[model samples]
Each structure stands twice: as structure tokens, then as C-alpha cells.
Target chain A: MTQDSRTNSIVINGLNDSAFKVRLNRNLEIIQSVLANPTTVIGLVIVILMLMMALLAPVITEPNMPDPYQMPRDWQAARSAPLTPGHVLGTTNRGGDVYYGVVWGARTSLKLSLIVVCLTVVLGVTIGSIAGIVGGKVDEVLMRIVDVFLSIPELIFALAIAAILGPSFTNIILALVVVFWVKYARIMRAQVIRIKQRDYVDAARIMGDSKIQIYLKDILPNSFSPVMVQATLDMGNIVLVGATLSFIGLSEAGIAEWGVLVSEGQAGISAGRWWASTFPGLMVFLWALAFNLVGDGLRDVLDPRTETKR
Target chain B: MSSADKTILSVKNVKKHFPIKEGVFQKVVGQVHAVDGVNFDIKEGETVGLVGESGCGKTTIGRCVAGLEALTEGNIYFDLPSDKIALLEDSEKQDDKKVSAEQIEEIGNSYDIGKIEGDLFNHYRRNCQMVFQDSFASLSPRQLVSDIVSRPLRVHNVCPENEVIPRTINLLEQVGLGAQHLYRFPHQFSGGQRQRISIARALALDPKLIVLDEPTSALDVSVQAQILNLLHDLQKKRGLAYLFITHNLSVIRHMADKIVVMYLGKVVEAGNTEDIFANPQHPYTKALLAASPDLQSEVTSGMAALDGAIPDPARPPQGCSFRTRCPVAQPECGWEVDDVVRRLEHKDSIFNFLKEVDQSDAFNAKFTFETEAAANQLMAAMKSDDIPDAMKKMVSKLNCDAEHVTVSFKPAKTVPLIACGNGSSARCVLVNK
Candidate 1:
């Protein structure tokens, strides 16, 4: 009886720890696994640096005034080479400051990718989850729509939508959102379908848990990892695609965007004024490559097949 | 430890058919009769073992009981009063019973698992819980042990928020776990430990009945015994009724008070555990018993191993579903045209030459072959030793004219389960005698 009482006290002490600690521990474990790989760490570093650059663009470079996103003109340093005093990283033939453009380009790309990713993820996950959970005729109709979206090549499809909507950064974002959400919808739908069949979901249902509760607790958490992996991969791909759209003159001229800077710099390339285009072009490549690396690492860590080992 | 009078659950002629869809439109072409017309009862504190091979619909029956799958037909009355259960049983036994149809309907509407809604359904859910076969699949990987075990308590508001933790701890302790295991995920535990966690979760709501769907099948032999013993002790302490479903006869023999032996989608034999073991009336039950290894029996003759594969559930045989595989199959055990086709379809020499089959019904068919010789060969094959004597004996007509060979079997009725004394029943023609 005394032994039982002693154990009971221990139980009480253990139970005092909040559920938050459990969640924290689980999340910490996943983070640890994701950070274990060297390439992921490198990608993470590049992503962090890029994010910092974007966040601190105003502090690093003086705002262009009226509209900070529009590149500041420097007529005196037009076509100037890199490292020239007051004209660092040179200037475009049209007098756009390349330094200001590179720094602010990060901010533009970040804003564009973040908005598109959030919108597409929300839209895709919602539609996919509804299709998966409801199933039958509703599933059929929704999936057919997803199929139509998925049938065309993503770039070509986005190009068509952007072209139709008229050339602008916002239109490009809208086009990216349309082209991107379908893959996520397909992924999330498949994941939900698979995870819903799991015994835990059925167990939850058997416990008289409402359909919404079952979806939230059993189905959603288990199925969200793959969506996350896809989201991370798309984070980089979106920027690359956005830049490509802007490169072809889809975006507003003289804006502080990497693709537009590259487009402006391309005119002076044969005259050896490559700094203007090369720097912004390099930023795009690094941004895409970094996310791709991180996404692959996340896949390796979060893939359900490998999850059992942990 | 079972109190013989009060019934906890009454499964009455339950059937569950899953549609097999085809084409892009998903048109329903056929149905897989997973559980067809199963009947049984679990009294308070009793353990009724549902034993069958895989695909015999034992799991489907368990799912039906757990309210996982909506029933295609019939009602599973939960926690009906003893008198009502007796009245229902009486009505089943005798068509001209005194109990009115409206009274049965009232009882079903209130107590049926499928039909009840609102507070009544919640009450049933609280009373009934299930421990799945795969512990890994049953417990949420993302949920902590405390959360997994305490979820039911919290959902039902069985206790205050603060009290949930202590109650969950108590439950864990009951299942042989400790407070240290509270914050750990499911993957942190061994197979046996995970199963213990599952049991703790099942016991959280103090359920009156727990459906054990092959709970120990995924564990090691030693672990299986430990889990079974824990379950037994828990049942004895809580007076919980259990519907233990498994294919392992040894496990069932050790745990079950009453045994229901199923073949295909129907129960072939059901009785008190000892009675079914000592005197298995159905050939399927006898074959099952002989197949299962027994320590007490020194000699392993292995004579009763059944031959032939289970027939397709979509097109289940006309009469006895097990007659196709039963060693002691009789002439009266339904023989149909499908059986002949099934037997000869693999024989390339005869089946490859067959052009078309004009099946008028299950028992009668005309085979139009590519050549007259093939038709004559089929006729010869029917009379040959390759066909079972019972099936050959049941054939009433066999004629070959040119490329057309007509074969007909004696029409047979669907076999019904007959009472074979001592609170037991068997679904075989021999049982009627």
C-alpha cells in the first residue's frame, strides 16, 4: 500500500507536465532529424541569409522614395563597372542602380513566393481534404478538375494564365497560384485517402469522435508532412518561375526584381557590363537551388517510409 | 466470471456488403458479401470468440460491432435488458411468438448501434471500445501516450480537466505501464508495450464491452500470452464483455467461453467452448480443430486438413458455402454449374476449346465448345474420378449433342443453422439428422 502511494505521487508529478511539452518534444525531434544532414544545413544557411537580406533591405540600402520597390536611377553611373565609388555593382544602361535592385529584389522575391505559397497551400489543402474526406461523386468531380489543371505543363499553364491576365507581378503571382495548387491538391488528396484508412482514424471514429475531429486529429497531422515537403520545394520553384515570367517582360519595367534587373542588364552584356545581370541572376539560382536542397533533405527526413526508423 | 442472465450485445442477422465498382464512372457491377447474416450474443462479462480464416468476414463482423462499417442489413442491439433479449431470441426461434413486432422495433430503435443517435449513441460509444490487431496502426504516432489514453475521457467529459491526467495515469498503471511512459510517442514502445498502451486507451472510458480484433496476432507468442492474460484479468475485474476475433484456434480455446466457427461469410458451428472442441458437428470446425496444434494430443495424424480454396464471395455457392472445401461433403451439399466451371477452368486442354457457356441458373448450364469432341470430353470428364463423387451424384442431367453439352444439378436450398442440443448450432445438412 505504501509502495502504491509512492508510485501514485510520482504519477501525479509526471502528469503535471503540460501537453505542450509533448508537442514541443515531438517537434524538436523532427527539427533535429531535418537539421542532421549537412546539405540541408547549407541550404538552411543560404535561405536564412536570403531571408535576412530581404528583411533588412531597407536598413542596408536607402529607400528609393515614393515607391522603394522601384529601382533608384543614377544617370551619372550608367553602364559603370562594379566597385566604382557610389556606383557599387555598376548601373544599368537605363540608369537603374544594380546594388539597390539586388538588395530589394530579395524582398520582392520573398514577398511574391510567401504570398503564393500560403495561398496555394491553403487552397490546395482545403480542396484536397474535402475531396478525400467526402469521397465518391464529390471526390470524382473535384479530382477531375484537379486533373485538368495538372494535364498542362506547369510553366506553360502559368504562362498562358499570366498572358491572359495581362503582364504584371500580381498577375504573375495569380498565375503561379493557379498553376501550383493542383500538385498540392493531388498530393494532399492522396495522403488524406491513405491516412484516413489508418486504424487510428477508424479508432477515432469508433470513439464517437465527430468527422471534423477525426480529420483534425488523426488524418490531418499524419498527412501534412508530405504537403510540407512539397511546399518547401515549391517555395524555390515559385521564385524561379516568377523570375522567368518577369524576364520575358511580363512584370512592370524597372521594378526591383531579379528577372527585370537581369532583363535590363542583358542589353550591356556584350559591352562587358555583366555585373548588373549576373548578380541578380545568381540570386535567383541560389534561391531556387537552396530550397531544392532543403526540400530534398526534408523529404529524406519526413518521408513516412523512413519515419518508422526514427 | 460471466453473469449468465444480462446480455450486453445482441447481433441479429447482420450483413455487410461492399460494392465492387468498375469503369471511370464507378458503376456497381457486383458486391463482395463481407459479412452475410451473422448472429451471436455476448452476455455481460462473457467472451465470445469469433474464429475463421482470413477473408471469412470475422474482422468485418467485429467492425460492424464497433460501428466502423455501416451495416447493409439487420440491427446490433447494444445493452438491451435481459427480458428484451429473451423476447427477441424467442421471436427468432418461433415465428408465431407472443412478442409484438412493434415492441421489437421500439427496442431496436433505442438500442441498435446503427440506428441510435444523439445521447443514446454517445452512451453506446462510451460502453463499447475496440483494440485493433496492429497496435502500431491503432495508436496515433503523433499523439503522446497520455493524450492517446486520456482522449476518450476528455471527449466524454468523464472527469474534470485536472482529473484526466490522474485517471490516465491510473489506466496506464492498470495496463502495466507507468507515469514515465506518459509523454512518449507510440513508436517509443515495443510491440507488446504498444499493445498494452492500446489496451489502456480502450479501458480509459471504462467500457462494458471491448472488441478484440486479433489483438495478439501481431505480437510474439510469449507477448501474446501476456496480453491475453492481462485482458483476462481486466475482464474479470471490470466484468467487461469481449468479442475476441481471431483465426488461431489455440488462442481462442484459451480465451473464449463460447466459440463461433465461421467459414466464408457464415458461421458453420457455434457452441460452448468445450462442447465445440470435444464434439465439432460441422466438418469445417473439425478441420479447423485438427489443423490447430494441440499440446494435449500426442499423435499428429493431420488427417483433417481441408482441400480446395474458398469460393468467391461475390458469387457464393447456392447452398453450403463450405461444401466446396469440406472433406465430408455430401451429395445434398449444393453442387452448381459454377463448381464445374471452377474445377475445369484451369484445365487448358478442355477450357481453352470452350467457346461459350449458357448458364440458365446456378445449377444448370449449357457449354457450347469449339468442337464436338470437346463437348464429349467434358461429359467424359464429369463422369471421371477427377470430379468428386458427391458433385457427380448431384448432377441430374448430362447430355452432349454436337458442340453443345448440357449439365444440370439437383436444385438445393440455402442451408440454415440447426440447433444441435446443448446450446449449440451447426449449419450442415448432417446437423438436421
Candidate 2:
């Protein structure tokens, strides 16, 4: 019923007849080995908790709903101190609750990162796969474009695009994908280049697959690992990138973004209200740290070379 | 149904030459003749062995036959009647632009290689497949065995989606795997097991011709034996035609119905496997057999150790191509100034000491000798009895008139595979055609 026992049974079963169960054990070992690393474990837990908070923020918190078009403050409970008990994290200078702002901020930042990472992975995998698999002139042309994309500073470019696109959540995500996807494509393209040259790809060709089918069926599956690792790491990066964009006042009008919360908290910092920025800022660090930890764990687990230790 | 009418694939004078550049600016340079003028045929329900050294172009010819590579010259006619291809050729002579319509139509209509359109290409593709060398690298790491094997069936719409798993199970069973393998990934399988999975995937289409390119070279010997036996049994059951390409002579002996001996880019010898092994005609084929390890027989009898590695296909020996190493090279095996220079480069250090080379032809190169003695040494080496008596016999003219010595050697013709005095064909001068 549980994944742990399932893994145990596979390991045990694998020792006897030593057939397909052996293969299952191999994949299980990779998953376990990745999850076993302390940093990865910690990162995964952090990411999981952040995602849960984002999803269940409505159920766990009772924030007084303010009009979306208007500022989020009662204007009466403004600039209240911490440990107000029912107001737990206290109130913002705008009379909006600081704890509630953080809960909403976690949801926003997490959503933006998740959306941006997915888009980047998809786009990166697509372009990278094409460049790597279909070698020669097409590859030459695509790799040069990737080089140009990679040459530009991702955060600054993301800010510029977000500013021009006028800062809806969609626009920020689009900007993140536009700026960050080149890395995935570059990683994926290299993986694909290596994979496409592999004997399995040759076997696929000998099996009489068209060039397109070979890319989709043969090259695509193998290409997913590096991209998956990149995607998980990019989730952390998108959060940092997104927060920076919001921090610079380029966020959508009235959105409760983490960087926006940090700026609002900044205005109140002089008056001794620190909760405004600290919680939102801490959320960003925790999520980003979690992604890097998970990324390192995934590299060892997914890489074929590391199997010897396992 | 007749033996004469049953050839499944006919490779007629296939040639594939890859360009090689030496200096700068990437000028039009020498061509590394990968598959040069190779010819063979696989009859229905027969496995043909194509054996040679590493750069002998056996795999290149196989790739050409499988339609994986476009031939620079000549054509691979799969499942076409030799008589029909000959007739199409005669027609091609009359009309220069005649090849596209009638020739392709003849191949398509006769053997049904299928049309060039969507379903047609799929049909032809389904009929032919390949098994690669490296088991660890061939199967996709991300895919489960089920997905890898069942992919062809799904792509061709050979079976309904639900039936795909069942069909895949059937294929797996045929290859010694079972239901438990359905969800397992390739990494879970052993080297032998992964190769089985690759074979099962190849067999998914029920193909007529499976291009087995070193199917067992990467596996352990025992595993290779098992795979070879498996292939033999499967061939019997499916009545499949096989292009069994390998560098191992013993494998070809066991598995190949007919054997083709290739050297550089040419078929040096070809005929029934029985005739080839019993009486190898080409000198290269003889050297290859002598060098190959034979398990059933002990070594050091009449067996040969090849004098040296194969010459670069880019700059093959001009006359017999094997003249450089041919123990039985003749006065007309095409020895040239290069051969004399080649001899001096090895035996005379003075020729080796030349800082630069100026060439007049392959047989005549002007060497800038540092001293008169070295130039005379280069001239003296050309006329030496120390060189193989046969190669020395190939010298037509020798001139050491320059500090840059020039030697004009005999120009021998390329030895094409022709029918010998016996029923078999050989590409050697030893046997009269």
C-alpha cells in the first residue's frame, strides 16, 4: 500500500529469480537514493509544505476579504504590533493583516514559480530536443539562437518583458519562460545530442522509425531526465526571478505577490514593523533552497554513473 | 516459390563514399570510400553473413541495403527480381531521366517495398528492421519495456490500444520475457535481457528482413551464443531473411547462409557459404580467414596472421588495393612509386627523414632527399630483394635521377569480383575467370 513497502518487496523479490523485478529495483533505487540525501529530503519537504500552504490557504486562514481593485486595508487596524493573538503576525501599516499577507504571498509566489517552471521546461525541452536530435544545419541555426538567448541576463530580461507585457500573472509567467527556457533547451539539447548518438537511437532507426517519430519516441524519453532536474531547480529560480520583478514595482496592480509584500513591509520597517517583509522573504529562501537541494539529489539518482554506489 | 525467384534483397554494386578533408579551407579532397561497389543477395528465409575488418564497410553496406543511407552510386533493390532489375537497367540506358517513374514502379510493384507516401513508407518500414550493438545504450532509459516494444505496433496501428499490451506480452514471451516485464524499464534488464527486448521490438512488426548489425558483439560470448541460437530458431519460425553483418568470422560461419567477404569498400569474394569457407579465393578473404580465431579447429596450421591492419579506405592501394600487403602480389598488381616510397619510408630512415614530399602521381612522388646517399638509398630500397619478391615483381620502371627521386611503378587494374573457373566468384588474380 505504501511506497516504502512496495520498494522493499521489489528489492526482496529481485534477489531470487532476478528478472524484470531487477529492473524495477534499479529504478526504485534511483528514486530512493535521490530522496535519501539530507539536503534533498529537506528541500522536498519544504517544497511540499509550501505547495500545500498555497493550495489550502483558503481553508487554513480567515482573512477579511478586500476588494481586488482597492488596497487591502481596513485603515482602522493599521500599523498594529506583532502578537495581537487573533491577528497572530500582527497588522500591516495599511491595516491589512501581515500573517494573511504571507499566506496569500506563499500561494502567489508558488503558483507563479510552478507555472513558469512548467512552461520553461516544455519550451526548453522542445527547442533543445530539436537542436540536439536533428543535427546539421537545423541544429547549427537553433544552437546559435539558444546562445543568444543564454547570453542575455535572465532576471533583467524577465523584468523588461514583464514590464512591457504589463504584469498580469500570465505575463510574468510568460516573461519567466521567455527568459529562462534557454537553459533547459541548452541542457536538454546537449542530453539529446548525446542520447541521439546512442545505440538505442540507432536501434530505433534500424527499426524503421521516421525522423520525427525517432525524436518524439526515442530521443524525447531519454531527454526528460535532465529537463526534469532542470525543471525542479528552475522552480526555485522562477520564484526568485518573480519576486525580484515584483520587488521592483513591476508587479500586476493589487496582486499580493511576495516581492510586493516585501516592498510594502519596507515602507513600514522604519516604524518597527518587521513582519511585513521577513515572512515573505523567508518563504522565498525556503522554496529556493528546497529546489537546489532537490536538484542535487536528483542528479545523483538520475545519472547512470552513480548506480555503482547504489 | 522457386529458389531462383526467392531472393528477398539484392544489393547491386552499391557505393557510398564520405568526403575527407586534409589541410585548410576544406577543399574537395579525398573520399573515404565507406561502401565501394559491394554486391550481395539474401534469398527468402536465408541469413547472409557479411564479414570483414573494422573499416571494411560491412555495416555501411548493411545500412545501405536497409535504406538507412542514400548511396552515392549504384542502388539497393530490396525484394526485387534480379531479372526485373536488369530489365529496368536496360530501359534506364535508353532514357536518361527514365529511372524515377518505371524503375521505382518496378521495384514497388514487383517486391512491394511500398509507395513513398505515408502508409506506403510505413508498410515498407514494417517489413524491415534492425538490431544494434550496444544493449546498454540502445533501449531508452525512460521507457518501460512495454512502451518500447509496443511503440511500433501503436505507430503502425497494427493493433488496437488495448490489444497492444497483450501483443507486447506475446512478443516478450517469444523473446523469453513475460508478463512481469510489461512495466519494467530497460535499465532493469541485464545486457542479455536488454538485447532480447531490442529483438522483441524488432520482431514486433513481423518483418521479412532484420538487419542484425553486430547483434551480439557487445555481449559476453555465452550470451552471444544464446542470442545467436535464439535468432536461428526465430528465423526458422518466422521464415525471415537476415543481413547478418559482423566482423567475427565464427559467427558468420554459424549463422550466415551465404557469406560476403568485403575489403575496404569492395566485395572481395562472395558465393554460397559452403564454397567460401571451403575455398576462399580472394587474398584478403584468405588473410581474413587465416587471422580469424576458429574454435573448432586449432591455430598455427596453414592459418595466417594478417601482416598489418587494413589500409585507409581514403587512400587505398591503387592496383589490387591489397598489393601493399599481398604476399602473392604480381607484376601487374599495380605497384607504383608510392609503394617504393612506402618501402623506403619503412626500411630506409633516410626516406623517412624527408621534411617534405612533392607528388607527381600515386606511383611517382618527388622526395626532397637530405643527401645523395639517402636518395640513392631510396632508389636502392626500391630495387631490393628484401621487399616481398611478388611486390618487387610489380615494378615497371625506376628512376633516381633527381635529389627528389622519382620511381615509376606498374599500374595494375582494380580486381572486381568475377566468376572464377569454378562455379563460385572471387576477386583475386590467382584464379582465372
Candidate 3:
């Protein structure tokens, strides 16, 4: 369909018995387009599978009754190859079931990444909007603080913060949030500065809307699309970074995090038991790839500049 | 025009001056006198047209009345009952200066919108709304038509939550849109449609007064007429008072009951629309009428184009602001050294020969030219017929020597608006004297 007709249909179908239904239809359309792209579909399948594993972690590991967080000591089954009936994807040198580790690893990876991304976005958007909208001296002070944080490289800053706080689940999440929030703050602040000057904002003021009401209802919603796309893409990177910290032992030693699994399996790789490390490593690659593809698909659908091309 | 007519809005000497900031510390350097001592009244069901060239502060005055801009000085009293208005007028008659802010505030039925606070401010906000010029930019792109039109109702709590949508639909229908347009964003519509949507949004609150700021400037001529007619019908139906701000004389001539002609932030002429159009008292008003194509007849030979641009607001010339460009400018039209310099600045050859200027004030200046001939030429130009006869008559002193000329003019006071017969007033020195 031509762009004009699509716009017309959007208008015609926009308001009805419920606004919720209109939003749902828009989301469905975006999903349909994402599915139409073959590469994105592959990514979607991987993402869905990962989500299922994360959600059904206990069920996946319950049949064998292996504790995902414990090291296996059954020497007989320790180095068993892939396709073992009791232990699929083989076993580690310490006899931990790789299948169990991978299944429960999805939960740790997804949870930490989600928590970090959500925290960063919330912190960044609030601070950024306040800074841009308030302007003057307050803006100058906040932006200088942002500059101070931004001047340090992300991995280095996160590492320094993590090292200072000591290895723990919450500390790692904190470090990631501190390092990632600056990116969102910069982008959201720029968007706020541009959007606030638009005449609609003035019109909203004339409509007797308070500043907070205008920000939440008129300004922020319009400025959030790019931030959302950025957040989606950042999710993949956040997981990777979390895993890197875990591999370096910033997290608990025997946790079922994918990076810890990779670190533990590195010892047996030269002994020709590559399946132990390779499977978990493949899972990490697939997780990041899924998020990246989804982010790309979202950009295509949400960004008006690219909508014309589609 | 009658004493029985009710006044919905009375703007008394409204002034809005915006400061110009310079350097990093944002030190105030000067102020732009956007609306300088403007006064007008809109009856409960009357349309008042504010006409001027761009930057004459017509929009600024509208914004002031709509409570969008805080006044620098002056008060906009809203919804004054006739008895209280008479009381206010009696206070004015006693001694306008002694009419205290408390006295002004004590008027039971009137609310001074510019100074009102809290609940009263919100009350005035709900009662007076504005329709902006740029419809596309004025409507939030992310919002649906239903939300945009219903926003005022929602903001003021004008309707129950469930009734908001239906009320919005009714407003859209009034503006010529239908249920099909409710869910659409502003980008989905053309310019004309977008303006209609804006109008619907403004009309949502059932305001007693609506300030329309160049509502039809961005639309096509045909579309302009349609919007004007819609406004006329809506006004008649609702008994709405409109502060219509526009530079388009023909549009105002058709819609306005009272026409106010502003020049450089001051109202130069104001009267009934037909009387002002038929017998314009102010030179600026006459120039504006001549420039309007629809008001001109083929038998009139040629349209009189307004010469020169609007004076800089920060440094507006000392007298009748219109006098600098008024064809009928007189000796008493506040001619100063600034006028001499203004004329010289535009004449390149004479200006290039100028060397130094020593001034005591706006009325006196001594010029040293490049050579004696330049000084002689300057003296001659002051007496030439090209100079307005009024200006020549006011030249109190003109002395020329080898390379210098000193010219002084009789100091003239700025002209104040004076009442002519037939409910018209003009700020012209000729008419005032």
C-alpha cells in the first residue's frame, strides 16, 4: 500500500471503543512486519526459545533432579559426550550437567540484563528530562556530571566500580547501570531539548497543563521511540557485559550464568570435550543476536524516516 | 455600541516588553516593547479585530488577553458586569491615578486576569482560550484527534470521564469533521483540516472569549473564507466574543464589529469596522486599507503601498511611531534628530560624506561632513521640498560652515490617541492638534 492510504487507515482505525485496542493493533502490525523478514524471524525464534528456557528453567532441570548451581562429582558421567539420554549436551569435567547449566543460565542472563536496562532507562529519562526542561543553572550542573561519567570508558568504569564494591549479584547490576545510564541520559536530553520547543508544547501550556502533566503526556511520549530502540539494542550488550564480569569472577563462583559456564568449561577444551563450552557459548551468541535483530526490526517499524522505504 | 451591551473583556494599557539577554551570564541589555500601552474592550457577543503589519504586536496583545503572556504593565479585567463597570468608571472619573489596585480588585464581577492568582487564574484560563496560527505545530503529533480535542475538557474537568469522547466527537462535528477523524493524528490531515481541528480544540471548553491569532493565514484563500464563515456561525450560535488578530484587512473587515489598527505596538486607530474602513482617521489605517486587494476598486487607479519597514521595537522612534512613515506627517509629529539620521542613513551619498555626529539629545545633533560642499548639501537638503513641509517648518536652527552643519528641530511631544467624531480615535499629530 502507498504511504498516504496507510496514513488514512491509521486515522480511520485509531479511535474506537477503547484506546488499548488501537495500541494493540499497532503492536500487532509491527510484529507482523518483523516476522515477514526472514533473518528477523530466525532471531525471533531464538529469542522465544531463550525466553521459554528462562521461564521453564525448573521444569527443564527437574527430570534429572540436578541442582543447576552445584558442581557435579560423578566421575563416570563427567566427560560423557552429547546425546546422553540422562545428560543431553554432555557434561563438564566436574560432572555438572551442561543441559541443566544452560537451561538455568537463561534465567540469570535475562533477569540481570532486563533489570540493568530498566534501571538505566528509568534513571536516564527522569534526570535527562528534568535537566533539559528546567534548563539554566540546573541543566549546566547535571550535564557536567554526565560529562564526568561519560568521559570514562564503559567497561573500564564498570570494572572499576565492580572491583571497588566487590563481586556480588547486586553490585554487578549497579556497576552496569551506572555505566549504561549515561548513554540514555545524553540521547534523551537531546530529544527533550528539541521536542520542548515545538509549538505543541506551547499549545499544551495554553491548555492549562502543568509542567509535569505536559512532560508526561505531550513531550516524553514523542521523544521515547529512539530511546526505546536504543534500549532494545543495549539489552544484548548488557547481557554480554554481565557475562564478561561473571567470567572474571565478579559474580558468585558456581552460579549458572553463561559466562561462568564458559569459564569453567575452558579447562577441558584441550581434552577434546569441546561440547561442554561450545554449547553454552553458542547460547550466548544466539541471545545477543536475537536482541540485536529485534532492535533492528523495531527501528524499521518505529522510525518514521524508514517507514517510507518499507 | 450601547451602554446596555455587556463587556466580556477590558484590556487597560497592556504592555509586554521582553528583555534581550546578552553574553554568558545573560545580562539584560534592552527590551523589545512588543505591546506598549494597548487598550481595547470586547463586548460579550462582539468580534474585535486587531490589525497591524507583522511585528506590530497584534499576536502579543491577543496572547495577553488570552492569559498566555504575562503583562509587563497593565490589567486585563474579565467578565465585568455592567453595574461594576459603571462603578469602575466612577472610580476612574474621581481620579484615575488614585483608583487603587485594591479598588480595581474590589469590583465584584470583574477578574483582573493578568494579576489574578490560583483559582481565579485557572478560572480565566478556562473561560478564555486561544487558537494559534500554526495548526500543524500547535497540535501534538502523537495525540489522536479525540485526545487533542478532548484535552481542554479533561484539563478543566468539564465533563465526566465517560462523556469526554462523545463530547469530543460533537466538537469535531461542529468543525466539520466526523467520528472517522477522532482517532487520527494531526499529520493525517491537510492544513485546512488541521486548522479546523485546532478550532474544535479551542471550542471544547465553551469559552466566553476566544483569541484567534491569524487563524487563516496559512490556509488557501478558499479555505480561509470557509474558516471565517465557520467562525462567524459559531460566534452567533454561542454568543462568543473574539479577539481576532490578523494583518489581513479584508478578513477582519468581514468578521469584526470593531477594528483596531496598531502601529509599532500602539493602537493608532480604532472604531467600528465600517466607519474605519469608510473614513480612516489614521494615516497607518488608510495605508493598510489601500494595500488590501479586496478593499481596493479598479477605479481607484493604484494601491498606496506602505513604505519602509516596522521600526525596531527596542529603539522605536520618539513620537507617533507611525509618523516616521506617515505620508501626512506634520511638524508636530515628534520629529527628532533620529528622524534626520533615519533619512540620512537611507541616502547613501550624503551619509557617506558624514564624519562625526555630536548630539545633546534626540532633538539636537551637529554633523561634520567630509568637505564644505557636503555640509552645504546637508543644509540645502533640510530645506528641500523633498523634506515634508511640516518637518521644514519645525526646523528651529540650521547652520553651515566650512565642513560642518548643525540642525535643530523644535522638540515635539509624542502624539497621544485623540477622539475624532463617530466613535473613532487616531494617534496623528494633525488630528490631535
- TM, chain A, every candidate: 0.94, 0.86, 0.87
Expressed as tens digits, the lDDT of each residue in B304-352 for candidate 2 is 5677667778887776777677777777677766566555555647555
User: Predictions ranked by TM-score, top down?
Assistant: 1, 2, 3
lDDT (Cα, tens digit) per residue for candidate 1, span A193-276: 989998988888777888888888889999999899999999999999999999988998889999999999998899888898
Tell me the RMSD of model 3 versus the true structure. Answer: 6.6
Which should have the higher DockQ, number 1 or number 2?
A: 1
Task: TM-score winner between 1 and 3, please give it.
Answer: 1
Task: Give TM per candidate.
Answer: 0.97, 0.83, 0.81
The 10-residue segment of model 1 chain A with minimum total lDDT is A11-20
Predicted structure with the largest TM-score when compared to the true one: 1
List, residue by residue over B1-433, the lDDT tens digit for candidate 3. 3233888898888899999988766689999999999989898888999999999999889878877778899778998777767767777676556566576667633478866777887888778888889887788877878889999999989977756776788899999998878776677788889999999988988888899999999999999999999999898888888899999888998999999999889999999998888888787877887888777762133437888888889988777888778887877777787777677666647767888999988788899988898888777777776577877788888898789888888887777889988898988866744
Q: Cα deviation of B99 in candidate 3 (Å)?
A: 4.0
Q: How close is candidate 2 to the true structure, as a TM-score?
A: 0.83
Cα error, residue B424 of model 1, in Å, equals 1.4
Candidate 3 Cα deviation (angstroms), residue B373: 14
Residue pairs whose backbone atoms clash in candidate 2: A23-B188, A200-B138, B334-B412, B337-B363
- Listed in order, the DockQ scores are 0.61, 0.29, 0.29
Worst 10 residues of 2 chain B by lDDT: B295-304
> What residue runs in model 1 are displaced by over 4 Å at the alpha carbon?
A1-22, B93-100, B295-302
* lDDT preference between candidates 1 and 3, better one: 1
